[model samples]
Target: MVDQLRPNPAYIEAVLADAALSPYRTWMGLGITELECDRALVVLDIEDHHLQLRGTVAGGVMASLIDTATFWSAFVRAPADAGVANVDLRVNYLEAVPKGARRLIAEGRCLRPGRRLSYAEAYVRDERGHVVAHGMSSVLTLAGKGLAIDLPKYLEENE
Candidate 1:
């Protein structure tokens, strides 16, 4: 049986439908291909807006991927009643994504999990499987903060 307390990877469409994630889902074409208690896989389809003046993927876009990946990795392990915040984020751009690259995939791993804080790292790769960026972040669970959707309800409904 799946653990209802944990984020459900199977119902990605339902999870992404939450209003809080609308920007990432609609604007950035971000999708969660995999999600677990301590890891996540996020993908972004390459588009014209993702490119910079040089025609390479913009650094901000890469950073956003890292941020989203790390955040989700940690969030999956956080308390169900709390909301997570990325307190610190650090990313290193390793390569420029070629214009022809179809998509970027980010793999995130939670290094440590705690009631109040969590640490996560993410690596972004181009469609060709070349590492383009690496990042790490610290996430904090804030009391009295709740997500826009009732996660437990969604999970139960979907299940």
Candidate 2:
């Protein structure tokens, strides 16, 4: 069996910083706080735009959080020349978050990592630690098709 892979500190910092440059991630105010060999933690500070007509957190926001967190959890284990793409995502909204909620915490874990595919799950909690949503995803590991951008250049250009 191949040894499990872990992202080094530099790689972790790179990923966290690069993620902020993504238009969608930036618009959603997503921030990565911690990364491990098989897991990642992300945060979103709620803003007015994140609320729906009902004054609750938008479902789309939660879905995006789940997808992003799950993707990164598996991404850390992929080879340098490989990239993981989400094949399917399923999310369950457990509770509605009040508009006044200060933040949301998302935790994602890779359940299985394979050469061609991977599985991951994630959960979102409000500032009070109430479960707001949960999700699972199937991701395809594409060999010879790594991330399109050069991390160093991307960072420099964004900065």
Candidate 3:
């Protein structure tokens, strides 16, 4: 099991709902049904027209979802004053996305976190149990001013 540390779901849900991040998702609809400190599970339900001409999820979209899912596992657990950013992210695709796919799941976990950097990893797959992609991510913890100061009331403090 992952450690107790985790980001509040309400905060994460709000971020996922942010329209600015839409262009970066497989579904053009970023979403997270589950979230926590060391682990997170996000889903992307893209439409057929949203796909590229080749009928696959755009590479940039895939990369963005991968980066976001992995980073959440680190940042959600960060101190309220943390400043975490992804330093480097490497993703590997093992299968192509189906044209009529319903959604993609990005399951991520934080391997370790410290004063400077946090290591994270995730598996991207469809409902069919196929291991479509995977990745390793590196998140840099900036100085104390990491988190948004005026957090919304829905986002609870990490106990």
Candidate 4:
């Protein structure tokens, strides 16, 4: 069995707290409360911006939640020097989130890990624990085409 490196807790914490690291996450007001080898838990506090003209949570918001959650779940299994990109994502919106819903939690789990591909599934739930959306995604891992930013060096410098 190949040994897998667990993501550092400090790094995850810093990533979540620093807006500069992920502008999209900051803009969406999303937080990652749990990140492990094969699972990730993300949360979003519903705001007016998240609602549509109908006063319910927009479909795009749920899509984004599933996308983010699945990415994190499969990312952990990727090689350190590899870049993972979602090649395919399928989402099913089950229930509408009312305007007054306070929060939404998205949980993602990696279903399969591979050298060049990974599969993940995610679910978005309302504060009442009703699943609002379900999603599945496949990520392609690219070797020698890692992220442009040097995350470790940046983290060290920031610390």
Cand. 2 Cα-lDDT: 0.83
44-125: candidate 4 lDDT, tens digit per residue: 9999899899899999999999998898888767765566788989999999997689999999998998888899999999
True-vs-predicted CA distance for residue 17, candidate 1, Å: 3.3
Cα error of candidate 3 at position 113, Å: 1.6
- The parts of candidate 3 lying over 4 Å away from their true place are 1-27, 149-159
Model 2 clash count equals: 0
Cα deviation at 18, candidate 1, in Å, is 1.8
The sequence of per-residue lDDT tens digits that candidate 2 reaches over residues 55-128 is: 88899999988998898888878875677899999999999997679999999999997778899999999999
Q: Name the top lDDT candidate.
A: 2
> In model 1, what are the clashing residue pairs, if there are any?
none
Best of the two (2, 4) by lDDT: 2
How do the predictions measure up, each by TM-score?
0.84, 0.87, 0.76, 0.84
Highest TM-score model number:
2
* Residue 37 lDDT, candidate 4, scale 0-100: 82
**RMSD to the hidden true structure, all candidates:** 3.0, 4.6, 4.3, 3.6
User: Model 3 residue 98 lDDT?
Assistant: 81
Q: What is the C-alpha lDDT of each candidate?
A: 0.80, 0.83, 0.71, 0.82
- Summarize candidate 1's per-residue lDDT along 1-159 as a digit string, tens digits: 236356455544444455235665579878778777878899999999988888999999988899889988887655555668899999999988886888999999989988899999999999889999999999998876756666677657766
Comparing 1 with 4 on TM-score, the higher-scoring candidate is 1
- As for candidate 2, its clashing pairs are none
Model 3, position 44, has a per-residue lDDT of 80
Order of the predicted models by TM-score, top scorer first: 2, 1, 4, 3
Residue ranges of candidate 1 with Cα displaced over 4 Å:
1-14, 19-21, 151-159
